[model samples]
Target chain A: MRRTPPEKPADYLPIAFPAAMLGLFFVVPFAIMVAISFFERVQGGFYQPAFTLANYGRFLSAFFGEILVFSLFLAALVSAVCLVLGVPFTYLLTKLSRRVQVAWLIGLLGVLSLSEVIIGFAWSTLLSRTAGISNLFVALGLMQQPRAWTPGFAAVMTGLVYQAFPYTVLVLYPAFSRLDPSLGEAARTLGASPLRAFLTVIVPALRKTLIATFIIVFIFALGAYLLPQILGRPQHWTLSVLVTDQAIYQSNMPFAAAMAVFLVIASLVLVLLANMINRREPAS
Target chain B: MSGRFLSRVFFAALALFLALPLVVIAGVALNEKKTLAFPPQGLSADWYLQIFTDDAWRAALVHSVLIAASSALISVAIAAPLAWFLWRRVAPWARIVQVLGLSPFILPPVITALGALSFWATIGLYGQPWTVVISHGIFFVSLPLVTITLGFATIDREIIEAGTTMGADDRTLLKTIVFPLIRPYLISGFAFAFVLSLNEYIVAYMTIGFTLETIPIKIFNALRYGYTPTMASVSVFFVLVAVTVFGLVARFGDLPKLLGAWDEGER
Candidate 1:
């Protein structure tokens, strides 16, 4: 009687309200995606209900697997680069006066709120094949137009870094702010250099934020489509791009569905593993 | 450390990185020549005129606005009730309900898009803008739910106790005190959801099936064919709308906190 509450319509109504609506929207959509992957396309591009593993087998294909590998490697690289770039910037922001902190926060917020597509478009112009920033580089004898900057792996990496950098900085800022000012002061008083104190004291304390920021950044970067699709070499496509290419350009819905499934699996595995490791250790 | 010197250099670099792209885009938009060249042949907002005149581009902008506005409303309405339930119920299932709300944000959008596309296709709900709104809405529902949850926690429990002592039931208390106070959080949540939905491309592009294009689809198409003067203008337009919308939200809401700030107590 203590364990279970009296049955009343009002008691469960609130919890049940969202459960039903959420079921209709989120779970059902995922089910359809999975179900469609196993079906064949009929005449006129309509989905035909037929059980098949042909779609799932495409994941083993060299072409699809290659793109997935490239994306994973690139995503990992960008995540690292974002952390490297973000930590210092976040440190700088935290050290600022309150008004300055607010100002700096505004800038970070602006970038965070800016869409992935906007960043992609802007970066493309700045590094366009011809008659753009790369062209300016050529005119100044810096590099040539139709430069190796855009439409390649390097460009995609750059864009992903730019997109994820703000999140990294924002996440790291709090960790940095939470640092004890007097610890660094005491270290300096005891003859430790600023850099040494930072490396020993500040860095260790930031481990949790570092992990959290990295996971969140990785999640966003890995799933990101626009930056890679625009800037990446078609041959060096991200899984997100591959999924879109298959679904939209090739009209290979089955193959696309397969790619989307693999993408989610990759993300889920990483998130679960990170959480497990974090829970076990408590901190790095 | 030469703190001031290092800070200045870092900040200047950041500002340039943030500003240069927009400056280049805006400059190219004004180029009298057809190509998107900087140090333009001449300056004019002719490209802006071209943006307004382009039927496909204009259609996409309209679609983006409509989808964003409607989705924000829908997400907020549903998330509010769900959050209220979770806060009041405190049952075992309430935790599951919160996770359900947040799961979409954690899950890859591509996977979500795929599922949504398939789901809609099977139901023959494809090509309808409402489908896009609902699909994005479910994902964005988490935003309002989070805000309202935080607001609920922040409210002075004693004030609500006082209200209850004054003969307020849950419904009356919600109307008299809870709703009025958390209104800012609610508004901010709506704005964030609306802005993000407007700017979203991958989901919009995949689910819309080429029958309807958003501003992002137009910019994407423009990139594929060529980066025309007009498209540069479109980029400028996007930046402006993004800046204004984001500026308003940051002004009214805890933008950094939403980005997962750690030192909110100090701020």
Candidate 2:
């Protein structure tokens, strides 16, 4: 269409509705959370209107520190595992025919659409003693009996990885598919093994994307609230679980808000870092 | 040959691992036993039947459908025009508007939920279904925004120029040329938003509180206390909904391009 003149005052009308909606519901709530994090926690599981740094101070305590550290460690682990498994898998996907690639992509989107609660409990059942993969182990004489895998770290990691794997694949697919097939083929013709060429050439070229995906997945895993509660022990709870606990269960909204503030800040930083990396590389 | 064979085996195993839990949940829903079991003591449709028969499950299903439908409608209503404005006119604030639309999606749902919870409470609108509808609509606006932008990319500039040279106003042009061309994307965006809203839990739980029950909240409560075959059946229902929604999107739209994996000059 011919370019419409920019002089129409009506040009600005469409932005008004969505802008106000986002401002009120999205930006305003975040502002409230920030303000509430500075409020004082009171007796009887309530918060007072006094200005205080106590909530932030609470985050500096050994207990909260441990929770934060463990959450970070778990998120890092999940991202690493996703990268390890996702890289090869996406590479293989790129090697497939376009029809098969589309089919796999559709299947992945279906899995990705499944809610965390469903994914969590589905894995819980799969790892439960009565009908778990352990039973298959027993049936095949790989082990003597079924074993409960829930209420443990491994099971939690399993669910996290399963949840994150599709995302990892989706994020990496664009980059991997855009890669020149001739690059690897040329490397092979130059007398390097296929595996060796991938490790040396392709992996290095994709280093930025790998890091970006890792940070994206890491931040996502950090915000995970339901998975730990569903699949792991109390010690396995992430900071998100603690935020909900302090807010809803313990009625300590200030503490919960404070923790959420830290969580959001950390996530924002990582997202910004990923954006920077993407800007530098432009491919991802 | 050996290396390729090994790689294929590894890929198949990994694919199976990715799919195992979901497949197992569906299978367990077929169990005739009261308790969940893998081999499913005997095949039956009773559990799936329970989703419709049980009052709480039925209510949750209805509530989820209403919320998702309304949210998708609200999202498309807001995003469609905004996308058109940004695409057609060079506005100074367009980048800011785009960021505002997408920030909810990029931010953690927990943060958005807490914010929405507090924001709604302040406005004395907490625990209302409309709060959830609005919250979800805003949170997922990015999906439609992106889809609609891609839809705009598909419009030929020459056709647009020809329409303008015919003295058609922007409104008439949008209605006649742009809307028809972008109808698939609009539908795809709505479906994408609907599916996401249906699957979302935290924002719905936080904004609406416990007063209104959505399927995810009900599932969370059930899973917390204990596991039941009924819960598995409910999950099966969700998996089916997701499959149906995404399948439709795939059937009608460019699923891969929609997912941000388009090749150069392909679209």
Candidate 3:
């Protein structure tokens, strides 16, 4: 590698602004949150500075434990479903013409950038009795009546899957596009069926990418807050939803902070694991 | 051939599945009545018009735009120099700085939002609109950091060398050569953060709460009460904004490359 000239003292000046901003906003706040997580909850829904593991210990209780377990399960399920559907779809997408690919990319980006609030709202409407797909079934004589599907596990799953599908595709796009087409062709020449070729050859070859994508999607889905509230019953709420409810409605900032801290640590570990896997995957 | 036909059908079905909710929302926005109906009891643009005409909804729209525009600008401002420093220097701390800049985005927004929520509350800045702007600016800094880094990577080393050889100073080289090259990247970065910030809910809600009625907050508050065609209309409007911004990015920038596709030469 070519060596550039040495930096001057003034070169450090550019970094100072962002450093200050992030340090003040990001670092300080996280520190405060960690501190608050250990603080004591006082009367009247406020908290005071103190050392206590009570907030974290509450996570061991049935209610909080259930939410934590359910959050992880939902995230894992969403990730798996998205990868199963998205991997194939993205691979097929790469085979299309560039113009068509760009159009699809735009559509995906639009969906990906859209607010969760809007998507939850849209799905709620789509799953409602008046505007839902069940109405179409009723119109075609396939059903006797329209049906409202919100406030259920299936509805929450559908909303989250829809929200996560775009991200899954976007995350997997580069890997799928970069895949050497001749590998599949070679498999085909060996008398392997197409499905067999995909199963045996392509899937294994991209295992690391697939794993990384799964973890990324998992982290995203685990943090879903609005969809559960809008589409599911209170019993189906995720940790994120509970965190918000605790802080805002229940006015328990200490517990909310503890949950948030746990979420951050969990995400960081998964991210590190993904990084290790990617680093070890002999750079293609 | 049978397998190929099956794959095509599968792709078409998935596309329809992806589009179903969006199509439903659009249909519902056109309903004449207040009730949410897909096939439309009647047709009217009144709800769409009401987004701008209604006081609460209009205020929310203005607040969303304000937060998005200012936060995007702040993001680019912070991201540009940080990316430049990383590109220009080869120091160990540069990597750490990059990680710090990117960490807010990589972690769940809820964690970052909670942190910001507490941070602001501690400093007595809670519920302030500018807190939302600054928090989002820092949180979404990774967008521009990635794009601008990509921008710097695309800059030819020889061009900078030539400028230096021709007696141009560091300032001149940056102003003439580097700045012009990265302009598109900066704009795309701004656009990406703008659209996302405009549509963001959790962070905005956590930081500013209901004090500033961003479109997402307004919609959520409204939903807790009941359904409104106006909410659907705003959603449709959001989709249009997102699509338009991304379409422009695709047209003006190398969309595939920005999206992580390997370069044509590399392939």
Candidate 4:
């Protein structure tokens, strides 16, 4: 073998600690839990290390299928909602003067800066009865009572939309801001109608960014914790919530690991698919 | 004109939607009534005071800060070397290790939580504060790494040569030149990791369960039993802290540059 050139070395001690931490705390424990799922519980919540897919088979439970489908629906819904709300502003912001663009960027940065937990707490109070600004519909005599927003599906949608929209907007903003605006204007000057110009020229220009935003938001909504935790009812759970309940409450290590593994696999698929689609995108 | 109107309304509604929650949480914190209420009957600071007197809340708050600071330091320490590798190494195994280092962070929290839960259990480190700090550090590794990488990438190649010709070794060049240039970015990245670790509830929850609760977990538990005005007071306190921190950041740092979404060189 040819000799390699000498170089300045990286600090192995620094990387070692975190890698070991991930291995010990994150990788190994999950491995044990996954291993346990196959065997029936023996004692002290420990299962004799035995291999069977029977526990995985239990995922055929109607609840598992139902939750999985509902989670997909919610993910798609949240992604679509964020896309709808995000696209126009991203376009408009890009079109605006730089000063205005920075103002909006700063605002979006603030929203994204706050933690997801705080965002959940904030929305819960906003939609809660009596004082929730949403409840003002009742006070104004537009409705009879404060809509049962939280601990329900509607609130789950609201929370997911809230959690992921800023991300969608932030990501898509750059693609829009850096877009070649003259192309769209040229299309208009060439006698294309406004909608047609947008549809044909602007749409294709934005196609990759939209796809990236959609995939990111969908995966994010799929794995969301606090939004659904605070907003959704107990039975109407996301895979994240369901896995959490299983691990912490039921102490069903194997089952929880199974669900968590499923979530990871699903996220990986979505992200990879997005990457493939993005790579296939043509130069604008 | 209609398109402009539509766009304006879209952003207006979005702004309202984002602001609404903070407003209510602050309002609820001021309720004079004992139970958590909307349209609180009157105003009071009792709940805010309660946060000070409550021992459990105090302990959780202290725990959160300690972990967040420790985790930030740990993340920076880890990131520095990783950034060095990413900046220098192009070898295949080196690349794989790089991805592995970031996998837990780039992936979702739920997946990381699941992995960490199992990872911690076997090592008998599952519920310790150190475990929480370590988990947090792992989760936020990419932020500091990316920031420092940016800081490193921006350093003109000639500067390193300039130092080397002055007879400086790698260590001296790094300490004397590289560190000073990236220090602000390092601080911002560290702050980002610190805030995120402090606010992260799910990882802490799955790993720690009730063995120890961070302030967010404590608040979550409190809400499960029943919402209290004191909870609102805590929310308000967080807002105050955010405002105070941002104010200091504005004073000591260029807010726009720190965010990393834009460049200082850009208009």
What are the TM-scores, per candidate, against the unseen true structure? 0.91, 0.95, 0.97, 0.89
Residue-wise lDDT of candidate 3 within B1-267, one digit each (tens)?
A: 998899889888878887889899888889898978888779999999999999989999999999999999999999999998778877777777789888987787888888988998999889988999999999899999999999999888898888888999878988999999999999999999999999999899988886889999988888888779899899999999999999999999888888888776877
The total of clashing pairs for model 1 equals: 0
Better of 2 and 3 by TM-score: 3
Q: Rank the candidates by DockQ, best first.
A: 3, 2, 1, 4
TM-score of chain A, all candidates:
0.86, 0.94, 0.96, 0.84
Candidate 3 residue-wise lDDT, A124-196, digit = tens: 8888998899999999999999999987999999989999999999989988888888988999999999889
> What residue runs in model 4 are displaced by over 4 Å at the alpha carbon?
A1-34, A37-39, A95-110, A113-116, A184-199, A282-284, B240-267
The pairs that clash in candidate 1 are none
Query: Which candidate's TM-score is highest?
Result: 3
Across A40-92, the per-residue lDDT of candidate 4 in tens digits comes to 64545654567777668877999889988988899899999899888876776
Off by over 4 Å in 1: A1-7, A41-46, A138-148, A178-186, A277-284, B53-55, B262-267
Per-residue lDDT over A230-249 for candidate 2, one digit per residue giving the tens place of the 0 to 100 score: 89999999998888778878
Q: Candidate 2: where are CA atoms >4 Å away?
A: A1-6, A44-46, A282-284, B263-267
Clashing pairs in 3: none
| Tens-digit lDDT string for candidate 2 (B1-267) | 887998899888888997899788888888887878887899999989888999988999899999999999988888888788788877766778888787777766788888887788767888977889998998889889889988998789889888889998778888999999999999999998998888889989888757988888888888777766888888888877887888888887778777767665752
Ten contiguous residues with the weakest lDDT in model 4 chain B = B258-267
Alpha-carbon lDDT of model 3: 0.90
Candidate 2 versus the native: TM-score?
0.95
